[model samples]
Structures are given as C-alpha cells and as structure tokens.
Target: MRAIRITEDHAIDVIEARVPALKQGEILVRPRACGICGTDLHILHHGFPGTCYPVTPGHEFSGHVVAVGQGTKGVREGDFVAVDPNVVCGECRWCRAGRPNLCLHLSPIGVGRAGAAAEYVAVPARNAFAVNEKIGAGVAALIEPLACAIHAVETAGRLRDRRVLVLGGGTMGMLIALASRKMGAGEITLADPVATKRAIATRIGIDKAVDPSALGDELFDVVFEAAGAVPALKQALTCVDKTGTLVQVGVHDVDVTVPINPFNVYEQEITIVGSNSLADKFAAATELMPDLQKEAETLIGEPFNIWDFAAAVESMAAGHAIKTQLVFD
Candidate 1:
C-alpha cells in the first residue's frame, strides 16, 4: 500500500507500507477522495495540536468499503460512505453533556491517528455514513466541513430573516454563507480580498460578494468570521449590528489576538460566540447535500493522486485551488 506520512521532522514523504488490518468493528475503506484542509497545512509547516508526528493527514474523505471487521453493522462491503474523523471519548464530561465535539479526549483521524490519505484506511465502522449514488465521493467528502459550518450556524442562534456577513471568501466562508442562506437569512454578503473567491461566492447565489476594502458601513445582524486571521476577526466585530451575534468559525493560532473595546461589547450587548468542530450535525449536512451539491462541486479543484500530496498542499497554499483533494487513481 502507498501512504503519505508527515515525519517527526515535519517533512512529508511517500512510503510503501503494509496494509493495516481492521480492528474489531472497523471498516477498511479505499478512499475515493480526501480534501486538504488548512489544518493539514498547519501540520506540515510545523505542528497542529493533537497531531501525533508521522501521521497520515487526511480527515475530510469519502470512500468505498472494501471490508468490515467482525461485529461491524449498518455498513457493508462496497458501500460508498463519508467518514466522520472525530472519535470522541464516550465517557468524557462534554460527551455526557451531548457536546462531544468538545470531548476532552477527542482523537480525530488524520490528526491524532492514521487517516485516509492512503490507498486504504481503517476507520471505526460507526464513523462511516453511507451515501447514495447521486452523491459522488468528491462532493460527499465535503459533508464533514459542511457539518462544521452547520454547527457554526447553530451556534449563531438563528439566521432566519437576519442580515449575514461572512468575513472571508474561502471554501469554509462560502460554505457558511451557503448554509446561512439555506437557513432563511434575509440577505447574505461575503467579503474577501481575493477576487476569485469573491467571484465564486457570487456564483453561488450570495446577495453580495465584495472586496474587504470595498465593504461599506452596512451593519449585519450576524457576522461570521471564517478567515481565522486577526484582521478579519477585528473587521467582523465592526460589521456586526448593535446587539447582533458574531460567530467565529475559523481556527486561529494560539498566540493570535484581536483588540476590542470592552465598553462597546457592554453597550451594544453584542453576542460573541465560537464554534468548534462538528457535533451531531454530520447527518444534517448529509441531508442538506442535495441543496448544496452544485456549489460544493464548484469549490473542489482538480483532484490529485495521493502521491502528489505536496502538489495539492502547494495549490491550496498558493490560493490557486479551493478544496484541493487527493483521490485514489
């Protein structure tokens, strides 16, 4: 089997490795497509929290089940499915509270354990969600991130008839905008520095997709900060209407900070919330796929084979691709 691993030295290399044997209640999946996320880049350059070294890094993936270990049920051989990478500790306080996304001991595939950036991956059978033929593996792979976006919107309280501004035009930003629109947001605006991303947002039916420099003084009922940069966060705070909600959906560096006036928050009663990874929204994301499929398809770039992992990373970093993915050729 061929696999891409990030060494302890943070160097990515391809290696010939023995196929992993399935454990009890696991499924052996031949990954059909795996999207490269920003976290993967963070892991490659230096480190990402909870990522053990020499890990195979791919979380957003869909594949065909080739075999199921004993006791596995609901999934079968040859079933096309998307894998939810987060494996939560069932006994954790957060899990017991029905907020497993914040499980104290969460192990995510591609981060804390071996992932699907290989010819085959052994995922717990329960993590696999079977998809119908109408959804290709490429688009189905987006279910994970879309689930995150759904969770973020849920954190935002309500979007119905609200003015929403997504402060980024990247893939996640676009997905957030799409989700907001579907939730009955009165108007959706996307702000991005990149023209290509803004254009893509416009193509996806956003009411407005504008350059950050050109974003006027219009206030929004809800602001979604998806860029994960301090500047974007600062701007998102300013874009929110009085007593509006600001949802931070992007992952940021631990050292990053933004300055804001304490009195402003007190005076406006602006609600600031943060959304982590997906919770129980994975199934909702899957159910919403028919509405999101067209735009989701547009967001993925040309697929590369697993061996071309470096190229995929380069494309994403260069901003030449939206959702660069690895696929079994």
Candidate 2:
C-alpha cells in the first residue's frame, strides 16, 4: 500500500509500506476522502507530538470499511463511515471525567498512530460513525473539521439572540458563524484582514465580513479568535462586551503574553475559554453532515492531490487558501 510520510528532515515523501495487522477491535478502511487541516500544517512546519521520523500524516478523513475486526459486528463489510481521529485514552482522569480531548496521552490516529492517507488504513471500530448514503463520500471527509467547529460553538454556549463576532474568516471562523446562526445569534460579524476570505464569508450570507479597522466601534456578546494571530487575540478581547464569553479557536502563530488587568476582570467579569479539538463532536457533525457539506463546499475553494500537498501547504501558510482538502480517492 502507498502512504505519504513526513520524515525527520521535514519532507513529505510518499512510499510503499505494509499495512499493519488489524487489531482485535479495529477495522481496515480504504480511505475514500481525507482533508488537509491546520493541525497537519503545524506538524508539517514545526513538528508536533508528531513521531520522530517517517510517519503517515492525515487525520480528518472518511471512508468505506473494507474489513471488520473480530469484536466488531454492527459495521458491515461495505459501510461508509466517518472516523473520529481523536483516539483518547479512556482510562485517563480526563477521559474518566468525560473530557477526553484533554487526555494527556492522546496519540491521535494521524500523529501517534497511523493515518488515513494510505490506500488502506486501520482504525478502531469505536471511532467510526455510520453515515447515510444521502451524504456524498467526499463530504463525509469534512465531518472531522466541522466537528471541531461544532465543539467550539457548543463550548461557547447559548448563542441565542446575542451579538456575535468572529475574528477570522477561515474555515473555522466560517463554521463558527454557521453554528452561531443555527443557534440563533441576533447579529453576526466576521473580521479578517484577507479580502479574499472576507469575500467568501459575504458570499455565504455573512453580511458583515470586513476589516476590523473598517468594522467600526462595536461590542460583542461573544467573540471568537479564529485567525490564530496574537493581534487577532488582542482584538477579540477588546471587542467582547462586559461579562461576555470569548472563545479562542485559532492555533496561535506565536506565543505572547495574555494581558490581564484586575480592573477589567472585576469590572467586566468576562469569561474567556479555549476551544480545542472537538470532544467527540463528530457525533453531532455526523447529524449535520448533509447540510454542512453543501455549506463547506461553498467555503472550500479548491482540492489538491497528494503530489500537490507541498504547494497546498504553501498556499495555506501564505494565507492564500481558505479551506483546502486532499483528494486521496
């Protein structure tokens, strides 16, 4: 089988590797669709919890079950399923407490475990969710990233009738906007420096996608930092209303001090939260996949093949692509 591997030299090389023997509770999936993600970008650039060298690196994916494990009975031989990449350690305190996203030893399928970039990959049966035939296979692949956004919005909580502000117009910010609207936000605004991204947001029913400088003075009941920039984070703080919630969905570009003033905290008493990877939000996304697919397609600008991974990564790194996905099928 063929798989794309990121070696210690920070190079992406595709090669043939024997598939791992399926475990007792796992199944072999011929990955039909896999998307490039920000997490993959981070690993490609800065080497993360990523293995030392020569590792397969795709996580957001969906596919057909080619073979089932010994203990798996419900999933049929040819079921189309969406795989939850966050393989959590169920025994950890966080997992025991139902917050497995914070699992200390989380070796997500793409990073610590093998990924779905190959012709065939093994995934735990428990991690695969059945999808309706009504949902296209290509769209099934988007469930993972959409699930991350679902979790972020759910964590923000209660979008009903509030003034919502989104700090980025990238994929995550668009998801946040849709979720916020679905949950009944009274007024929603998206701010991004990229004119192209802002244009996409506007095309997708976001009336207020604009530069922060041009957005004028306005406080928000909730603010989300989706650009993953320190400046955006600072601006998000400034835009939140007194005692409103702020969710940080963007991966930071660089570390910086989070300014805190007792006066602001006491006077406004705001609640700031970090929205990390979805806590099994895939379940919700599975339910929303049909609608989300139509929406994600409009937001996602293009598809790139494995051979073009480097160029796609370069475009995304340079902030050229809004949502980029890989075509492995």
Candidate 3:
C-alpha cells in the first residue's frame, strides 16, 4: 500500500507501507476521498495538540469498507461510510457527560493514530457512519467538517431570527455560515478579505459577503471566528452585539492571545464560547448531508492523486480552493 507520512522533523513522503490490521472492533477502509484541513497543516508544520508525529495526515474522509473485524456488528464490508476521527476513552468524565470532544484521553485519527491518507486505514466501526454513495466521495468527505460546524453553531445556542456573522470564507467558514442559515438565522454575513471567497459565499446563499474592512460598525447577534487567524478573532469580538454570543470556531495557536475589553464583556453582557471538535454531531452531519449535498459539492476543488499529498498541501496553503482533497485511484 502507498501511504503519505509526515515525520517529527516535518518531512512528508509517500512511501510503500503495509496495510493496517483491523482490531477486534475495527474495520479496514479503503479511503475514497480525504479532505486536507487546517489540522493537517498543523500536524505537518507547526504542532497541533495531540498530534503524534510520523503520522498519516487525513481525518476528514469517506471510504468503502474493505474488511470488518470480529465484533464490529453495525457496519459491514463493502459499505460506504464517513468516519468520525475523534477516538475517545468512553470511560472518561467528559465522555460520560456526553462531551467526548473534551475527554481526558482523546486520540483523533490523523493526529494521534494512523489516518485515511493511504490506500487503506483501519478505524473503530463505531466511528463509521453509513453515507449515501450518490453524494459522491468528495461531498461525503465533507461530513466531518460539517459536523464541526454544526457543533460550533450548537454552541451559539439560539440562531433563529438572529443576525449572524462568520469571519473567513474558507471551507469551515462557509460551512458554518450555511449551517447557521439552516438553524434559521435571520440574516447571514460572511466576511473574507479575498474577493473570490466573498463571491463564493454569496453564491452559496449567504445574505451578504464583504471585505473585513467593509464590515464597518455593524454588530451581529452571533459571531463566529472561523478563519483561525488572530486578526479575524479580533474582528469577530468587535462585531458581536451587546448581550450576544461569540463562538470561537477557529483553531488558534495554543500560546496565542488577543486583547479584549473586560469592561465591554461585563457592561454589554457579551457571552464568549469556545467550540472544540465535532463533539457528538458527526452522525447528525451525515443525516443532514443529503439536504446539503449540492452546496457542499461546490466547496470541493479538484482533487490531487493520493501520492500528490505535498501538492495538495501546497495548494491548500496557497488558498487555491475552498476545500482541497486527496483522491484514491
């Protein structure tokens, strides 16, 4: 099998490797499509928390079941599925409390375990949710990020009839904005510096898309900082209306800090929240994919062959697409 591996020294290479062996409750999947996300970049260059170097970097993926191990009852070989990458210790307090994203022992695939960046990868069958093949592999692969976006919106509480602003026009931002619309946001504004991104947002049904500078003094009932950039976070904080909620949906540097006005937070009753990984929304995302399939398809760019992982990474870094993916031949 051919697999793309990133070393501790930040080296990436596609090398021939043995196919993964399935554990008793695991299933071996031949990945059809895998989306390269910001987490993959973190694992490749800087360091993301829980990343175990010398890892195969792809978590947002959909694949066909090639082998189902003993005790893996719900899924069967030959089924198409979208996987939830976060592997949690179900015995942990957070997990017991239904907040598995915060589990004490969370080892996500592509970060802490071998991921779907190869000819084959094995994951717990429970992580695999059956998806309609008609959605196409690229759209199925988006389920993971869509789940995260759902969780972010879920963190924002009520959105019906609320003015919403999403910072960024990347895949996460766009998905977050779309999810906000589904939740019945009265109006949705997506802000991105890139003109193309703004156009894409407009095409995808966002009420308004504009340059960050043009956001002016407008305030939103709910603000989501999905750009994962410090400047975007700062801008998001400023755009939240009094008594409104601000959801931090971006993955910022662990050591990064931004200035905030304590007086404003107190006097204006601003509620700031941090949304982590998908939590338990992966299944919900798969269920909702059919309705969103068309719009989700538009976000996927041309895929690079599995071996061209480096080129895909470069393209993603260059901001060449809303979503960059790797496809299996």
Candidate 4:
C-alpha cells in the first residue's frame, strides 16, 4: 500500500507501507478521494500537537469498502461511504453530555490515529456513512469539512433575514457561506484579500465578495472569522453589528490574541462564540451535500493524484489553490 506519511522530521513523503489491519467492528476502505486540509499543512510543517509521527495524514476522505471486519453491520464490501474521523471515548463527561467534539479523550483519525491518505485505511464501521451514487467522490470527500461548517452554522443560530459576513474565502469560509445561504441569511458577504477567492464567491451567488480593506463601516448581523489570522479576527470584530454575534470557526495559532473592548461588549450586548470540529453534524452535512455539490466545484483546484501530494501542498501554500484533493488510482 502507498500512503503519505508525516515523519518525525516534519517532512511529507509518499511511502510504501502494509495495509492497516482491521479490528473487530472495523472495515477496510480503499480511499478514492482525500482532501488536503489546513490541518494537514499544520501537521506537516509545524508538528500539530497530538499527532503521532509517521502517521498518514488525511481525514477528509471518502471511499469504497474493500473488506469488512467481524461484528460490523450496516456496511458491506463495495459500499461507498464517507468517514467521520473523530473517534470519541464515549465515556467522557462531554461525550455523556452529547458533546463528543469536546470529549476529553478525543482521538481523531488523521490527527491521532492513522488516516486515509493511502491506498487503504481501516476505520470503525460505525464511523463510515454509506452514500448514494448520486454523490460524487469529490463531493463525498467534503462531508467532513461540511460537518464542521454545519456546526459553525448551528452556532451562528437563526440566520433568517440576517446579514452575514464571512471573513475568509478559503474552502471552509466558502462552506460557511454556502451553509448560511441555505439557512436563509440575507445579503451574504465574503471578505478576503485573494482576488480569485472573491471572484469565486460572487460566481457562486454570494451577494458580495470584497477585499478586507473594502469592507466599509456597514455592520452585519453575524460575522464569521474563518481566515485563521490574527488580523482577520480583529477585522471580523469590527464588522459585527452592535447586538450581532461573532463566530470564530478558523483554527488559529495558540498564541494568537486580539484585543477586545470589554465595555463595548457589555454595552452592546454582543455575543461571541467559538466553534470547534463537528460533533454529530455529519449526517446533516451528508444530507445537504447533493445540493451543495454543484457550487462546490468552483472552490476546488485541479485534482492531483496521491503521488503528487507535494505538488498539492505547494499549490495550497502558494495561495493558488482553494482546496486541493488527491484522487486514488
């Protein structure tokens, strides 16, 4: 089997390894579509915390089942499925509270366990959701990130008739915009410095897409900081209307901070929230995938084969790609 591995030296390379073994209640899948996420970059360049070295690093993936383990049910060999990489302990207080995203013993497949950037990946059968042929492989690969966007949308709450501002035009930002539009947000605006990204946003029916500098004094009912940059977070704060909500869905450096006026928050009754990874939104995202798939094509870059992982990363780092996906042979 061939897989992309992140070694202890923080280098990414295509390596040949034995296909992972499946345990009871798990299934072996041959990944057909895998997304190159920001987290993957973080892992490759900065040694993302909690990631074990020599791990295959792709979480956003979908494939067809090749082998099924004993005791697994509801999925069979040849079934096409999207995998939820988050593996919760199911015993933690947070898990008991229905907040598995915050489970104390969180072990996501790509981040902690072995992931799907390979010819074959073994995951618990329960983590895989069978999808209809109507969902394309590229679209099915988006189920993971879509779940995160869905969670962020749920955190934004009641977008009906409300103006929404998304402070990024990357894949995640676009997903947030798509979900917000579906949820009935009025006059959706996307802000990014990248001209390509902004153009794509407009082409996809977002009301407006502009450089951050052009974001005038007009305030929005909800502001989403999806750029994952400190400056973008600061800018997002200023775009929120007096009583509007600000949702931070982007992953930021742990040391990054932005100054906020305590008085302004108190006086305006403003609400600020942070959304992490998806909890149980996978099903909802899957259900919504067919509707979102058409517009999603504009957000993806030219697909690369798994062997060209380095080129994919370079494209993303050079800001020429919105989202890069690797296709299996």
Error of 1 at 207 (Å): 1.0
Among these predictions, the greatest lDDT belongs to 3
- Residue-level lDDT of model 3, residues 91-120, one tens digit each, is 988999999999999999999999999999
Q: Please, what is the whole-model Cα lDDT of each candidate in the order they appear?
A: 0.89, 0.81, 0.93, 0.89
TM-score against truth, every candidate: 0.98, 0.94, 0.99, 0.98
Candidate 1 collision pairs: none
lDDT by residue (tens digit), candidate 2, 191-270:
98888888888887875888877756689988988888888888888877887899989987444577856677568978
Best by TM-score: 3
Clash count for each candidate, listed in order shown: 0, 0, 0, 0
- In the order shown, the candidates' Cα RMSDs to the true structure are 1.0, 1.8, 0.7, 1.1
Q: Over the stretch 168-249, how does candidate 4's per-residue lDDT look in tens digits?
A: 9988999999999999999899999989899899988889999999987889999999989998998888878878999999
Which residue pairs collide, candidate 4? none
Regions of model 3 farther than 4 Å from truth: none
* Error at 324, model 1, angstroms: 0.9
lDDT of 1 by residue, 242-267 (tens): 98999999889877888887788889
